[model samples]
Target: METVRTVCTICPSACGVLVRRQKADIVGIEGDPESPMSKGFLFPKGLSAIEYMRHKDRILYPMKRKGERGKGGWERISWEEALETVTERMGKAKALCGPQSVIMLRGAAKGLPDILLSRLGNAFGSPNITSMGFLCFVPRVYAYNATFGCFLYPDYDYPPATLVLWGVNPSETFPPLFRRILKAKEKGTKLIVVDPRRTESAQIADLWIRPRPSSDILLCLSVIHEVIRRGLYDASFVERWTLGFDRLERHVEGFQPQVTEPYTGVSPEEITAFLGFYTQGPSAIQEGNGIEQSLYTFQMQRALYVLEAITGNIGRPGGKTRWGNPKLVERYGPLFTLQDLIPREVRERRIGAERLAPFAHYALPQAIVQAILDGSGPKVAFIMGGNLLLSWPDSKRTLEALGRLEFICVSDLFLTPTVMMADIVLPAATFLEFDSIHMPPDFTYFAHVQQKVCQVGEARSDVWIVNELAKKLGLKEYFFKDEYELYDEVLKEEGITFEEFRRIGFLLGRKEYRFYEREGFRTKSGKVELWSPDLESYGLDPLPKADPSSLQSDPSYPLLLTSYKPYPFRHSNFRQLDSTRMLHPYPLVLIDGKTAASLGVKDGEWILVETRKGAARAKAKVDDVKERVVVMEHGWWLPEDGTFLDHNINVLTSADPPFARETGTPLLRGVPCRIRRL
Candidate 1:
């Protein structure tokens, strides 16, 4: 037996891992003790990596649809035949409807697959490459970039004396970060959690601030108002490293705690207490993706940045900090450069480009569906590593739009609902079966060299598949001979090598603080822009606002429905794995015991969760959630039982309107809904 250092790709956390193999077969998996990041700890998902890779449901070979779309029948086909068929169909579609008619979408798979998909679209002269970024971290990244000139990451090395976790459950979604938080807590660090539901992290928090769903903007603004009103802000730092402070002060005057109390469900005293605790030196706020799925996402994130800046936590040792040394992997170096390969005319033809501005570079899933329904969307689509029907909101409409597509190709490890709608399916290698690079989920500091431990059946790495496709499409310049060649090209400027990276397992430089002191913020003003002139130029608000009145709840659907990822699953993945499934056997709707009792719903009983868009069935799980809030499990599907049509939360989510104006992000949280016993 031999042990190889790698990284877990089970979820976005991408923790360092050690894979044990016996003559080409994976024998065991564990956390890497040598790595400083995770420090010999692994989540249950990481420990079950070997079993997940060797699961019986894995698609081992390429297959072609033998019957109509949505039919379960398929015929095994060689990679060559599959590639030729896909290339021919794509070429035909492009020839008839221009390059803009072919769209490339990436799913949950990280690293090479996502980049290659974007590169393929660019090289093929299509500008409609898109992914889950619209629903994930892009809004926060964009907000930070616009406000501070660079994205600031929470500094966990020297954790803050007070850390505020807003709308994020690091304990479940991010194990490494959770471990760091736990260590900091052991050392007397005060924890403040903000979420509608009582997450595991919130259970032990020094203070749990439960706000109304989608009302985080009001809460953040109220805190900012209190800090300013109490003069708890850092006057020295504000005078030196910030711009438009006076404008921000005046802008937040209307968001005082009393004014926001009804909307945010936090009293003035609580807001003042929060400010008093957070204003103490060495404080940090770790924003999560949950807020990005809410209404006014971009504005909400900008308000959080403003809060950090006013408190002098911008460059503090235990606060939000700039990125460490550059990552070893060039996540989008080629794709960034290749994006221009698509001509200006084709680029302008991108769906939703006219309205979404900065986010126009990628196709909007909602807009893609609308376009398809109107016969103006891309005629052909290539999807990799995701379940479109399950992940995208308005499931029924998305499915129908996909059905209308002229051709659909999916590359994944299993036949999902989206794959069932595809004309061709390509087998993809799991993380353990590929040699690549990985970084932690948010605020990434280090890059880990993912070593291939075993190869499963005929599954191939995404890089290999893309390379072959590039060759078939006559895009020789974008094709790499092998993973070695790709890695060499990526590390050419850094002078590092794949061999060195593999041996070392990780590449991270010493942490640097007070980056703004030297170079200042990377904004147009060369300082932290409390009020952004760039936003004004784009016809958006220069200062963020908390307009709780913007969202009017429907009396028919009184309760606010939200969603959360199960601790044992990564979105829709791992539901078929017995070990993982045993941890969370079914989808659940978490409600307060009082609310459950009022609705006559008992724990473990099946309940119907209905929204304006659709409805789904889930087992009721009584929790300490707010009376008006209901937390629904995200990404639910039962492949083994062949009942893929039920239990997914997106079925009840709408993709229609009320998106973050700047980012085109749909409101995945705070939707009006009602629940009844099923």
Candidate 2:
């Protein structure tokens, strides 16, 4: 038997794992003790990667739809035929309705596919590259980059005097970070968790503030208010290293804790105490994707960044800092590719650019859905590594918009509901079967080479499929011929060979602390802009303030609904895997026991969760939570039962208008909902 060291891409945690395999058969899998970030920690999803790779329903060959779309009928086809048909159809669509009529959509697979798909679309002269970015990390990425000239991430490597986990439970989304927080707690690190639910982290948190849904911006504003009013802010840092502090002070005059308490549901005393602890010393704030799903996501993130800046945490050793190669200069791989391909005319045709241009670079998925429904959108689509029907908001509209596409192709590991609606289904290799690069999504300092362990059936890597399709489309000059060539290209400037990277298993970057002390922040003012001049030019709120949520509730629908993904599952992936499924057997709606009793609903009873848009059935689980908040698990679909809308959470999520003016992200979280016993 031989052991292979690789990183797991099941989630953004990207834990390092050692796979023990004998020839083509696998023995077992365990955490790599030498991994600096994960530090021998592993998630259950990572352990079941082998099962998912070897599952009976794993797509191993290319197939063409044999019946009507969404009928689950397919005929096996050669890779050559699949490539030819896909390219020919894409060409036809582009030629008939211009390049803007073709769309390339991507999902969770980050490293190569995420970058390559946009390049592919732009290389083909389309500007309709869309994903979950409007509802995910893109807003934070843009907000931080605009303010700090780069994405500022929490420094988890160093212990802080205080750590504020805002709207995120590391235990469920980021297990490695969760372990790090636990270790920090052991050393007397003051922990503060700001979430509506009593999460695992909240159980041990020194302070847990449960704000109302869509009220986090208020909480953050109140934190800033208390800090400034109490004169606890770092005066030296603000005057020397930051711009617009004076503007911020005047702007926050009316945002006292007593005034914000009604909007945020946090008392003035609680707000004062939390900020007092947070401002004591070096503190780090870790915001999660839960905060990124609201209609006010961009403003909310900007508010959090302001909070971090006022406390003198920016560019600090134990606070918000960059954690990558400081000396590395050259850009390579897909990052470089994304810049060179798109022409200006095509870029001008982005779907939601009119509304989201200031805050985001890409088109919104909801805009694409609306365009398709109105018969003015892309006629063809190439979906890679995502289940749009199960992952995106409003499964009904996603299906309808996808069904309208003249040509559709889905590349994935399993035959999902999204796959059932495609003209061609390309079988994609798992992470274990592909030698690729893994960059931690949390802005960590290291990168790992995920060496291919073993080939599983006839599945092909996404890079290979993309390269082959580029060749078929006569864009061969744009892509590398092989995955190794791509790897070498990405590492060409690093002074390391691909073989050396594989052998070393990782590449470490020198940590450069207090980066702004010498070079200054790379913003318009060359200082941290507490009140953004860039935002002011666009006539948007320069300072972070609470905006009313897009949706409101009346007497008919009185509860607030927010969606959460379970730890064992990554969006819609791995639900068919028995190993992970055993951990969470059914779709659950988490509500307070008191709320359930008041509504005449019982624990473990089937209930109809209804919103103004739609409704879905979910089993109620009573827990200690805020009475008005109802949390439903996102991406719930059964392969055996094979019903897309019956129990899926997206049925109740709206795909309509009143989106965030900056990011075009619709109201997925903080939606108005109600529940009744079924």
Candidate 3:
């Protein structure tokens, strides 16, 4: 019998994995059947974990850049030399700037963020720490905090009365959750998928609606207006629990179905009919029905929150609502450095307009890059988990800003395009080979343990690396220790031992429901805040409205471009994996059938995707999936075309600030650009 315990690092899903190892190496990876979260199922990436390790571009040991950055020039070096160089540069940076000048930007790596983020800035006395979340989920978290005073994460197990799958395609991103949706479907629950493209999840849904790109705010506002106009909303709930319903009502009064049809390309009555599924037919329609959406995404999430709240679906078993679970203080990985053990500053110094872009003003990286490149923003950048250059709103300009970083450090598995530019690049252990603990869904309270399977070279867990660096910076005496010792400290607080987590791969307790309690919501007033004090403090309009105000599209930009995550990929990783890469080996642009026909373009041919900032070439995948939608997976390497495709795609994307009112989560899916045949 082979012993194995692993976890998927493919994406944030963090699904529990069970591996079969021979001697000291892993031979196979599968979903842990023992896991209550995954139920023994795995995503494509999880099943092909071994194959990913065998990819061509994998680095086996520590290496230093030997040539000009981004030239793929590297020289293998000892870990001592690597650590020394990283510490030297960081020390010099800490000396020149008041620690606040240095910025730590990390993404997706396991168990290291809190440890590094909390300590790195405070030790240096800087609050400029940011991550890929600065570009992704932080906005959602920010909105949830501002609106409901609690995060109402989508609960797959919650018995929803009417399910609305919007923007997100969890069937690919969260395959395990997809099964939960399927289970709901089996129980005669209605399914509705809303997206700009005819995604796999959308194709199989009971209703699929592809509205105009970037028009989600308008589309949702219409639904709310219709629900209110037809008296479909739960009046008692809105009258009692909501704030600014009157102001919000005034905003949506003029946004009738007919008014939104032109702006959103969604017919008035079809939108009306869709609204009917949840809000009509007396108790038969939604009394116990669920109105769960796939994080609707962008401002769309804000709009969906309104629908759920007005319907009294909130805190109901079968409706969307907020969850409150005990934080997994125990088994949550140890604080790696004494510097990090120091509590972070609670003053919450204003994150400023640029910092607020993802949370407040959507397309912020464009401006953030401009400021950085001009030496106007935070001068030093330390990136940890995420690859921002490849994941920002405008990839092209992000690359340019990356080149201008006075000091940059990245801790990542592979030397990504962005990593190539780092002054210091730390090696990170793969997920299957890390010893850490986490709350799978960051909003929930379940704890999953990630234990090592095989020694993949000498890469260290990020916790170790951050601790090692802090030790060099003379901050070790506080709380930093080798992982096991630190783990013991963390374990002591939770009544869980390392032996317990290692044996079970997780230490779980009885799951608690977020809402549906006999009492009421966990809000300040004990009722969900459709109106809240936080929103008013943030100077945000305290009402959810369909405010789809378009930025003036230049005539030069004739089409709308959006990037979507594919089934077998995460960020920029695994493109080199044979099993996964075969699905769509290279970046291919998708165009609507009508758009292609009109442009004298055919499927599977080279085309030029151009915007004001730049242009790139790609093969076309013409389909009727979306009338005017064109998409390409992000983070494709510069060497993609026969080992060097010049189409970095980022150049053509807009570097403008995001288009959100209170939150600035960039509508990356609705950027403006036109595709032309090569």
Candidate that would win on lDDT: 1
Please report, in order, the local distance difference test score of every candidate based on alpha carbons.
0.83, 0.82, 0.63
Q: Which 10 residues in a row give candidate 2 its minimum summed lDDT?
A: 326-335
Can you rank all candidates by TM-score, best first? 1, 2, 3
The lDDT of model 2 is 0.82
TM-score of each: 0.97, 0.97, 0.89
Where in model 1 is the C-alpha error above 4 Å? 327-330, 333-336, 439-444
Please give the RMSD of candidate 1 to the true structure. Answer: 1.5
Question: Where does candidate 3 stray beyond 4 Å?
Answer: 109-115, 280-299, 322-327, 330-368, 377-379, 441-443, 508-525, 638-645, 658-663
| Model 2 TM | 0.97
Query: For residues 1-678, what per-residue lDDT tens digits would candidate 2 score against the true structure?
Result: 999999988777778899999998789999999887787877788888888998999998999999888888899999999999999999998788888888889886466567667677767878788777887888887778667777777766577889999989988888888999988888777899988888998999999988877778877887887788889888998888778888888877888888878766789889877976798668999988878887678888988888888789987877878755622223323355564467665576688787775546677887888899999868998988888888788889988999998889989998888888899999999879988877655444567889888887778888888878988998877777887787787677777767888897887776657888778888978888788888888877788765543345667888999877876888887789888778888888899988898989888999999998899998999987776899988888898767779888889888887777778877787788899998
Ordered from best to worst lDDT, the candidate numbers read 1, 2, 3
